[model samples]
Target: MPYFDSERFASLLEKEGFSASQAKAVINALNDVVDESTVNVTDDLITKEEQQKTIERYKNDFRQLKTDIQRMEKNDVEDVKSANERLKADIDKLKKTLQDELIRSQAGVRLDLNLEKGRIRDETVEQHDRLKNTDEKIANEIQALKTQMQGIKMQILRYMIGTITGAGTLVLGYIHFSH
Candidate 1:
């Protein structure tokens, strides 16, 4: 608080043409006003030292929180990397499995084709053998028929010659009897 010399203030007001009693009364009233306007210091307001300590504590807490957040982020990144590696391994396995299945399928198809080809070849050979046997049987039957026809032709020729000879003999006997 600044020093307020009431006597000096009263002297100055008296020099300004106020009476001594009025000057004293004015000084008393000013003192009352000053006293009324002044703020009283109390325990509710904190000291600078206490404020500095609180700020330090808050700074420390903030640093710890930052560290914790960084650690959590690093762990999350590692987990993501592990999961990515597992996915890559699974994809590789699936590709290999698909390739193996394709190979097996192709091999099975090839085996079936080979078996089918063999079966077709056997059937074609059997059909050819049957046709050959049928041709041979037909040839034999044609030869037997030709032989039988030739024997019948020879017998008819011999019978025709014998009848002609008997007719000639009868004519000769008739002429001799008439004579």
Candidate 2:
């Protein structure tokens, strides 16, 4: 709200060659216009303190959001790392099992050959074919597991990137609005 200094305004108008009555008339008219046109706008406007409080609230919220996101990211990464380790352990276990199976198979074939010399050749060939098939199946399974692990890794990377991008956007928004 601005004050209308009618006295000063009338004095100025009189000094500028207006008659005293003319100056008074001009001042009265200006006063009327001011009274009609001006409205009390204080209730509708935000005080600086209120604005500052709002900004502070937003900053706190932003910080909490950032912390939560970071925590989630760390947890997600740890989970992926642990999952990778488990998969590797599983693969190692599978390899050991395959080796054990092969050794057992060889021992069995040898025993059969000793016990049945006449049919030893045919049994050995049959055992060899079965081992080959098992080996192929295991290899294919290992390859499939590897592919699945790769896919999981890629998915985690994409999620991390998207989260980082979202966090960056929030940071930029905070910066823009703070001022």
Best by TM-score: 1
Task: Give the Cα-based TM-score of candidate 1 against the true structure.
Answer: 0.52
Off by over 4 Å in 1: 2-5, 13-44, 117-179
TM-score of each: 0.52, 0.49
lDDT tens digits by residue: candidate 2, 49-86 = 99999999999999998888767666766666676677
In candidate 1, where is summed lDDT lowest over 10 consecutive residues? 170-179
Candidate 1 local lDDT, 85-127, one digit each (tens): 6755765685577567657755765675566556657788776
Which residue pairs collide in model 1, if any? none
